[model samples]
Target: MFELLHKKINEIISLTDEEFNYCRTAFTPRKLRKRQYLLQEGDVGKYQAFVEKGLLRSYKIDDKGVEHILQFAPEGWWVADLYSFFTDEPSSFNIEALEDSEVLLINKSSWDMLLQNVPKFERYFRVLLQNNLVATQRRLMGSLSETAEEKYLKYTQTYPDCMQRVPQHMIASYLGITRETLSRIRKQLSEKK
Candidate 1:
């Protein structure tokens, strides 16, 4: 269980065995079955979860009852509602398991302790945040300016694993396209290949 976390952390920063063993104490493990809610809208987001297995997604339901996916967390990814976690506010997003998932969770207090104890993690999280911002900005730009086909192609290029694991309608929601449009795009792309 800690192996994947160790590997992921090592990829970003070096932590000695003694340091890692201490750091792991800050986190608690949780497992959720497919379709289960990890964080619900209106709830205070208490934990930032690191994915050790399976997949999770954070999304919102509009007044029209439409689901707009914000992000997906697969193995080696991190999932949380940053706003709620930091501000003690209610979460606007709902995080749900797309598949049965195992995650290591740390609350704000434990997270702070870990950072203070293992300063290297501050750097690791900084890098993670920077990359997330870049991807978010790019995705927003694409949503505003790119054509449906272009967006679909980019989505596939960006998250090929999600293409395999997520449902078709949810994929359409993520791409900000209609199910019929996604179907058309997929068919066209398939023919081209």
Candidate 2:
């Protein structure tokens, strides 16, 4: 269960066996069934979950009942509402399992303890945050300026696995395009191929 966690950490920063053993204790393992919610709107995001198996998605529903997906956490990825987790405020987003999944969860306190005990972990998390920020910024820019076809193509290129695992409507939501628009784009692209 901890193998993937160790590998993911080592990919960012090397850790001694003893150090990794100690670090592993900070996380709590969880199994979520498909359609189950990991984090719900109005709840405090107490845990940052690392996906070991299956997929999870963080999204927000607008007053019009439209879902705007923020991110997808497939195996080897992580998901959390950063604002709520840090500030102890209610989260605006809901995180749900897209498939039966195994995740390692660390609460804010555990995260702080891990960082304090393993200083290299700070660097690991910092790198993750920096990449997340860049991706968020790029997505925002694309939503503002890119055409629906361009956005769909970019999404497909970036998350090819998600294309198979996620529903078309969810993909459209993530791309900020209508479902019909996504269908048309997919059809056009398929014909070109």
Candidate 3:
């Protein structure tokens, strides 16, 4: 049941079997249907989830009520509103399953205990958060400087799997382009190939 979590954690920090077991004990397993929300704006973020199966996304609704996707979390990924999860703030975004999903959720209390009991987890999370921050920065930079075509290319290169997993319009939204523009880009690329 903990196989994917074990693999993901091991990729960053080597944990003894006992440490792994202890860590697993802190998390509650949850299954979400597609379109079900793990979190929503105005809710105090409660838990960070480690994805074991399927796909999920975090997004925001603008003042105009248009949805803007912020991130996609496939298997082996983690998703949460870090601000809410860390600061007890109400979430500014929503996290929902894009497909039926299974995840391991650790509440703030459990997270604290896990970090204390398994110190290696500190390094594991630091690395994970660091990588996520760097990636977010890179994406922000790309969005400002890159063209629609470049954005699409970079997105496809970075997340080839998402094409099959996420709807095209969501990908377009993430790229900051209109869906019709994305369609044209796809057509141009297909013709060249």
Candidate 4:
């Protein structure tokens, strides 16, 4: 279960075997059922989860009660509301399991302890956050500028696993398009091919 986390950490910063073992000891493994909420709206997010398997999504409900998906984390991905996790503030978004999921969870306290004990972890997390921010920015730009077909293609290319696991409507929400529009776009893309 820690294998993915270990690989992810190594990809960012190489750690000695002892350091990897020490860092791995701080994570708590959990299994979540489908539709289970990890963090709910108005609740402070207590933990950042690293996916061992399955899918999870974070979304916000609009005033009209429609869900606007911010992210979908599949196997080997990390999911968290950074603001809520770091500041203990209520989160505007809710994170939930889209499929039965296995995850390694690190709470704020544990994460702080790990950072203090393993300074290399700080570099790893900083890189992770920087990459996430860049991806978020690119997604925002695409939402404003791209057509539905382009967005769909980009999403599939980036997260083909998520496309397989997530429902079409949820993908539509994430793409900032109506379900009918997504259907039409998909049909058009298929016809083109």
Model 4, span 1-193: residue lDDT tens: 8988888788889999999888888899999999999999999999999999989999999999898998999988999998899899999999999999999999988899999999988898889889988998999899899989899999999888669888899999999989999999989888998
Q: List the residue pairs that clash in candidate 2.
A: none
| TM-score per candidate, chains pooled | 0.96, 0.96, 0.96, 0.95
Candidate 2, 1-193: lDDT as tens digits? 9989889888889999999999989999999999999999999999999999999999999999999999999999999999999999999999999999999999998999999998999899999899889999999998899999989888899879777899999999988888998998889989999
- Candidate 4: where are CA atoms >4 Å away? none
**RMSD to truth, every model:** 1.2, 1.1, 1.1, 1.2
Stretches of candidate 3 off by over 4 Å are none
Clash counts for the predictions, in order: 0, 0, 0, 0
Q: Which 10 consecutive positions of candidate 1 have the poorest summed lDDT?
A: 155-164
Candidate 1: clashing residue pairs, number: 0
Stretches of model 2 off by over 4 angstroms after superposition: none
